[model samples]
Target: MRVGVDIEDGGLARITLRRADAGNAIDLAMARGLLDAARACAHGSVRAVLLTGEGRSFCVGGDLREFGALSGAALERHLMAVTDALHDALRTFAGIDAPLVAAVQGAVAGAGIGLAAAADVTLAADDASFTAAYTGVGYSPDAGVSWSLPRLIGPKRALDLLLTNRRVPAGEAAAIGLVTRVTSPDRLAAEARRTAESLRRGPTAAFGATRRLVAAGLSADLGPHLDSEARALAGLAVSDVGREGVAAFLGKRDPDFTGGAHRL
Candidate 1:
């Protein structure tokens, strides 16, 4: 596989897109590798995931050369399969008990943008760039960009970016709320990893439930999701960990929760 994955203390796994020479472009093999890594992270001891690039660029986009060879049914099938698999991979990312933080530097375009938007939180280096390159050529946004963009930057901003294929830098990206935080290139990794570690060491199952509720709230009305949230809270409120947390807060001491979910 062209990607690399390592899990350290705090249950945080760092997954690097390793094709820096080509600006970490997603080729066929790399797409499969990314999906595999996401699935592995979903099932592993990793509570949080830090997505990054090995060298200069986080990910330039999909390999254009790979697109040239396709035509008619073959082309349609190729594009559909890759995008579908990638979307599936990203959808699973949301289910991760701990947050998914993207540590981005350099170019992030096309499918790369999709990957970034898939993350629960994004941390970009001062030099990082973002572009929706799909319309620049003769393609459309995939990797659930249509779904994610409207949620991140609003529908109007997403339409403008997609229509114009504009290249946005870190400062502008942060201002527009596409990325959560931006730091100096030297501190990007540390900053992102720190956030991931914080999440990893916190309430695992509660985070997972919260994530689901938030996602559900995005598309559905609060009236419908209220019931779901009520059920989740009810379950948590009766749990031993919750009682301990409440006691610890009232007693002015740190909560010791041993009822951590091993499956997470």
Candidate 2:
């Protein structure tokens, strides 16, 4: 399998891209595997998620070798098949309430960029590099790159990367808001895990509400956005976890967010 999924008793789900020899490239099998992993992790029991890649590189992108073997109609079919699985996986990850964390290293190109951007927090290794490889290969963006990239880095910067296909180093990526943080290569995995663990203790319902509010901001007017913010805050304030949080603050104690009484 090109993807690996592991869920621990503590509700931490780790998803790894496993096609090391192929630079963790996404082929049909890999896409399906990703879809399956996403489905499995989209559950109330999953408090947080960690996404990473095995071997020297995180992911070099789609399986070009497989793509090269196809004709016109065959190529079209393959593209649809691969995208169907990939888009579903992305949607599943986005729909889940848990915080998403990614630890990326080496070559993060093409769809790999989208994968990293989907994370609520992305920690890129110092040596990691990013590029939008689609245009170079006579293709357009996929895997939410078009949607997420512009939102993360602004339209102009996103266009620069996509049009030029220039490799953005880890430090530059962080500066441009493409990644949440940058860590030394040796510390990437450990740091990402720590981040995930911290988020796991958070109020899931509140987190979900926050995510929705931000997403809503994208297309909403100022008035509508403010309305959403007010509604979401008011709703969460009465939730069990929210109540505990407030009580803990006044009591000078740590709040145990049980993700209380919130259903997905």
Q: List, residue by residue over 49-122, the lDDT tens digit for candidate 1.
A: 88998888998888888878888999888877777667677877876766788988999998888888878889
The C-alpha stretches of model 2 lying farther than 4 A from their native spots are 259-261
In order, candidate lDDTs are: 0.83, 0.92
Question: What would the per-residue lDDT of candidate 2 be over residues 1-264, giving only the tens digit for each residue?
Answer: 789999998788999999999999999999999999999988788888999999989999999999999979999999899999999999999888888999999999999999999999999999999999999999999999999999999999999999999999999999999999999999999999999999888887788888878877998999989988988888888878779889999999998886444742
- Candidate 1 matches the true fold with a TM-score of 0.93
Ten-residue stretch with the least lDDT total in model 2: 255-264
Candidate 1's C-alpha runs over 4 A off are 257-259, 262-264
Model 2 scores a C-alpha lDDT of 0.92
TM-score, each model?
0.93, 0.97
Residue 127, model 2: lDDT of 97
- In Å, residue 70's CA in model 1 sits off its true spot by 2.7
Candidate 2 has a TM-score of 0.97
